[model samples]
Target chain A: MLLKTTLIRLLTTAVTLFGVAVVVFVLVRVAPGNPIAMMLPPGATEADIAALEALYGFDKSLPEQFVIWLGGVLQGDFGTSITLRRPVDELVLSRLPATLELSIMALVIAVALGTAIAVIGARRRGTATEVGLDLSSGAVLSVPDFLWGLVFVLLFGVLWPVLSISGRIDPQIEVDFTSNFYTFEGLLRGRLDVVQSTLSHMLMPALALALPLAAMIAQLLKQNLKEVLLQDYTTLARVRGFSETSVILREALRNALLPTLTLVGVQFTFLIGGTVIVERIFSYEGLGNMAIDAVINRDLPLIQGIVLLFAALFIVINLLVDLSYTLLNPRLRHG
Target chain B: MTGSQTHPNTLDVMQLNIALPNGHRLLRDVSLSLRPGEVRVLVGESGAGKSMIGKAVLGILPQNLKVTEGEILLEGQHLNAMTPWTRRKTVAQSAALIPQDPLTALNPARRIGPQITDPLVRIHGWSRTKARETALALLDRVHIRDPKRVMESYPHELSGGMRQRVLIAAAFAPSPRLIVADEPTTALDVTVQKQILRLIRELQQETATAVLFVTHDMGVVAKVSQQVTVLFAGKVMEDAPTERIFTDPRHPYTRALIAATPSYADLDRPFSPVPQALIAELQDDIVRDDARHQGGAR
Candidate 1:
């Protein structure tokens, strides 16, 4: 029964993804000026535009274009980027690692900071500690990611000069496997100094992106923990002589993780969107930077591919969230 | 009195008074003592402070409740004087509570075995294997048909009756000296209620564990209790052996309560409500007595 249900959900998700792809494709194509015109120069003749349009298959009907594009996508051909003149797969894959690293770091920071603040706030509910947590989380959420990035840049980059102001790494650093400096290739050589510098450079942007997400998660966890704390099992645990911290962490928090898990999944999707502005502010060469560049250059295939990647990510994340519900709740697993 | 046998008392609540934050007293100098192998039932109406007494004995009162004036002695030791930590280890070891709502009482996310063995591991420092063995035995004692299956099941998987039985098993896992069961079978069907009550009685007898059973149902009180304390508006109106109380209730409120109870013979007769005037009089008397007692104690 469980396997059947999971298969059904997967099939439904696939249909939903296809629907989303169709809508995004048509909406991007029909929004305004043609992709062919955007690629042409100012004094181009009608014949020149028509030839280019036919060459790129822009002259075909919308449905035909959709089928062709989807077929190519299914065949592992996402088409070539008009701006970079490179294959969309190569461009996306090249930027994928940097984006994943930044997102994973931001997520780790969010979970750790959010959980700590939430636990402390829950333990000291109705006290000054709770008030302080509420105020700070609210303040952090109010400040946008770009503003936060700029503030950190001003502090660490301008005032103290402890970190670089712009760009991912120092241009002067050489790419090698041994030397320790501020470059990714240098870290591949087991260079601890290079790893350190790269981490320092990424830290501010990562924090800038994580603060709002952390605040949102902390608010969710604190409320959930408080409600679970009032449950009878917590009382029973207390009467059973379990210490306060053990009951809170083992019993209360474990039950609270279900909601937090769902929230974290959603936050992950938001992080992709949030990183766009943060990347622009910090000039970090992540997927968000590539996305912005694609939009500016009106690279249709590149934009479509990135959107598809994000949608696929969202679908996988939701599936994992659904599966985790079974792991966290045994009743669901057995029943 | 001097030559009387020196039997060990499992629990002693002396001149206990509990007041709610709403300026109403829940328990009024209601004292009771349980011997090593006794089942004492606190029987009254829904708001008669029976469960309040149970909470006070276990030191698990909800927030906004104050003990006001009282002493709870467990195994001849002062429970009120011990620190919460020491009290948690020793006093809690001596007593456990089977709450009214078994569905919410056990952690839904946890397996039944771990929930039952938590106290054994935390308080007694038992190994996991030992705790598991004890938990299975307890499940068996509570008449769980398949102890192994029950151990693996979560609370949500069990029926209401099964969950209550599981809770009973957990309460008995530590072999506590006293078990305060507050309306354990109230949420089950009539047949399941009988089964739960019978299981509780049999387990108490086998373990020689004293039970402070709280219920509004006089039928349940008659079935399991050796002695009965009748509470009206948070005060003990009468205290005696169960048979004697059923046959010859001395307190007026106790008499009205018994008369109000539906029986097999009275099922055909139109159900009658206890007069509001009498309930009001009882409430006034309890308040007056509470104030007088408070003044005298102070």
Candidate 2:
């Protein structure tokens, strides 16, 4: 049954990805703007434009272009970006590490801090600390990440300036690197300063992404945990001599994590969508910005490629989450 | 099974009283004691505080219910007077509870092996290998046919009876002096209930662990108990030998309960709830008792 469920989930993911590919391929074309016009020199003649169109294969039928692009994609080619004059795959890959690092760091902060706050809230249900944290989380959730980004920029960036609010690192400092991922490259090169610089730059954007996520995670887990604590198993744990800490962290958290896992998966996908704004605010060069640039300049190939990548990542994450249910619930593994 | 005895006064609840933070009494002047290898069954209706007694004995009352005026003694040590952390650590090692619902008693995420070994591994610092072996042995002792398979399977994978058996084994894993079985068979069928009761009895007798069995079922009491403590609205209505309580019950409430319980000879008998005025009187008694001991528990 587990195997059958997994197979069904995989098939659903494939169908959804295919649907997204078709929708994105059509949607970008229907939207008004022209990458061809933008790429031409200011005084270029109509004949020059048509030559450039023919060269780029845009002069073919829309179906022909899609089929050609689809073929290349199947062969691991994402076509060239008209505006950037680079392969869409190369552009996405170069920015992929930064976006992944930011998203993961944000998730880690959200889960860790959110869980800690939630545990405190659960333990002190009606206390002032619980009420205070709850109110703060509510306030944070209401504010958009870009707004938070701006606030963080002024407070941590412009005002106090303890942490950089934008970019992957200080553009002034140069370093020889092995990987596109700054922290990994710094660690590999034994450069502590570079690692620190990377972290400092990531702090504000990560915080802007994390605070609202943490609030949501806290809200999700806190309610479930409070209910779980009243369960017979928690009482059993107490009777069995498990420490107060152990009961809350291991037993209570394990049961409370299921619903929160779904939220985390959804939040990750949302954060990728959020990257356009987050990257723009922080001036961090990631696929999110590349996506916006593609859409505004009507870089059809780049937009199609990025959207497909995003859709595929979302599908894969969902699959992993579906697999995680068996881990969280033993009953599911048997069924 | 130690096949040897330890303390005569394994557990002693002296004029125990439990109340909410708002000062409403939950248990009033309730007291019961257990000697090593003896089973003392707490008999009461739904709200008679029978389960509360088990929790009190284990020193694990819910936060709302305070032990305002009682000292629970374990082999003569005053558990109520000790610091909470100290009391908890001490009670955790010395006592174990077999809660009412087998389905809810075990953590759903963990397998039987780690869960059963929890007490020994966490409390005794046993290595995982040793703990798993000990857990498997305990499962075998509980008559689990495929102990290896049972150990590997999670709580949800096992039947209710199987889960109860795993819980029974876990409760005995630490070799506790007191085993608080709080309606351990309430969720089982008649046959499974009997088997679990018998298993608990056999294990308690073998280990000589003082058993505080809390249940409303008189049949359960008849099957396992040596002494019975009958409660009414949190007050002790009667405390006597099991045979005496069943054959010649003194309290009007006890008499009514026994009358309510249908026997083979009395197949058409309907349950008679205790008189309301008598319950009101019991409630008044608790209020007066609380007023008299206003500042602190006696």
Candidate 3:
């Protein structure tokens, strides 16, 4: 049953990705500016622009160009970045790890902080501590992540000056990485120094992206937990002689987490998308940063590649969420 | 502790008064007792606070509700006099609850094996293997086929009857002196209810455990209890031996409740609800009693 469901999900995901690719291809072409014109110097004649357009296949009819692009895409070729003069696939792959690492760090921070606060808040529902949590979470949730990034930049980067705000790591440190996933590579290679440098640089931007998400998670989970705590099972746990802590942690938390898991999964995709603005603020060398540069230069192939990657991430994450739902809930598992 | 084994009564609840924070009473001077191997069913309508008595005894009352005045003795030990921590420990070690809504009573995310055995190993301090063995044995005693498979299954994997059986097994596993079966069969189908009640009764007799059974169903009281406490708006209107309560009920509320139950044998006898006049009278009496009590306190 599990395999059948997974296979169906994979088929749907492929269809969705293809749909996304086609739409993005048309949409980028429909934009006001031409990629070849954006690429060339203003002093260049129409002849030079025409030659570049023919070479890149932009001079062909729209349908012909789409068919040609689709063929190349089927063969793992996303064409080339019109501005960067590099393969779009290579550019996206290299930058993807950096974004993944940051997003993962932010996700870890958000879940840990969110769950702890929610447990405390829900356990003390009627108290001042719970009230304080509600108020603070409300405040945190009202601000967007990029604004938080700017605030972090001012507070930690300018005032404190304790952590790096620009780039993924300090250029001064030298390390050979087998993979672009710096943090994982650093950990596997037993090079704590590289990991430390990468983390210190990542902390503020990740936290900026994380704080709003954490508050959202806390609020929702707290609400869910309070409802679950009032359930007959939690009362039975108490009557069974389990401690209050265990009653909440053992019986209640898992039930409450089902909904929170879904919310977190949905928000994580947005958190990655949110890195576009946050990355620009931190000047972090991740996919979100590259995406901005591609957009400004009207790098059509790069834009399509990046957008497709983002859409793919969204679909895959949702698939993972569904898989985990089955793992967490027995009825789903059995069915 | 040794003397408690020979104690005449396993549970003693004296003049227990539970009230909401806003001064509205839920249980007004309610009291009952349970001898070993006996079932004392608290029967009432939905708002009659039958379950409140069971909750008060088990220390599972809502956090918002306060025990304004009461004495609950578990095996001759004054539970109210003990510190909160000690009281909780005592309650955990000596009592268990068979809850209403079997569907929600077992944690959905947990396995059946750990749900029953973890308490034994953790709270009762039994060895892990012994707890597991006892759990399996109790599961078998509940007439669940293939106890090992049932233990490995989640609550959602089983039918409502099966979940209730698992709960009965868990309750009886520890051989707790007191088991509060609060409308344990209310959520089940009619066919399943009889089996669950019989299973509970069988386990109670085998363990010689005192059970505080709460139900609104008069039929349940007749089937399960040796003694019946008929409650009206949280006040005990009748306390008598089960046979006497059925054959010669004294309280108007009790008579009305018995009349309300459908007689399966007599198709001609009409089923009637408790008369509104009797309920009004009961509420009026409670109001006067509350006023008198308030005046006395002043």
The number of clashing residue pairs in model 1 is 2
DockQ-based ranking, best first? 3, 2, 1
Ranking by lDDT: 3, 2, 1
Ranking by TM-score: 3, 2, 1
Q: For model 1, how does the per-residue alpha-carbon lDDT over B1-298 read when each residue is reduced to its tens digit? A: 1112366488888989888776577788889999887999999888888998888777678878989888988888888998888887876678888888888998888888888887788678999999999989888877889999988888888899999988998888888999998998887888899989989999999999999999998888889999999988788889999999889888877888787888986688766667789889987887688688768757
Report the alpha-carbon TM-score of model 2 versus the true structure. 0.91
Preferred candidate (TM-score higher): 2 or 3: 3
lDDT of 3: 0.90
Residue A19's lDDT in candidate 3: 93
Where in model 2 is the C-alpha error above 4 Å?
A1-10, A41-44, A170-178, A188-193, B1-8, B125-134, B265-298
Q: What is the lDDT of candidate 1?
A: 0.84
- Individual DockQ of the candidates? 0.61, 0.70, 0.81
Tell me the TM-score of each prediction against the true structure: 0.90, 0.91, 0.95
CAPRI docking class of candidate 3: high
Measured with C-alpha atoms, the lDDT of residue A233 in candidate 3 is 86
Query: What does the lDDT read for residue B256 in candidate 3?
Result: 91
Instruction: Summing lDDT over every window of 10 consecutive residues in candidate 1 chain B, give the lowest-scoring window.
Output: B1-10
lDDT of 3 by residue, B15-115 (tens): 99989999888888987888877899889889889888888878888889989998999888899999878988899888989989999888888999999
The lDDT of each candidate is 0.84, 0.85, 0.90
Real contacts retained, model 1: 0.73
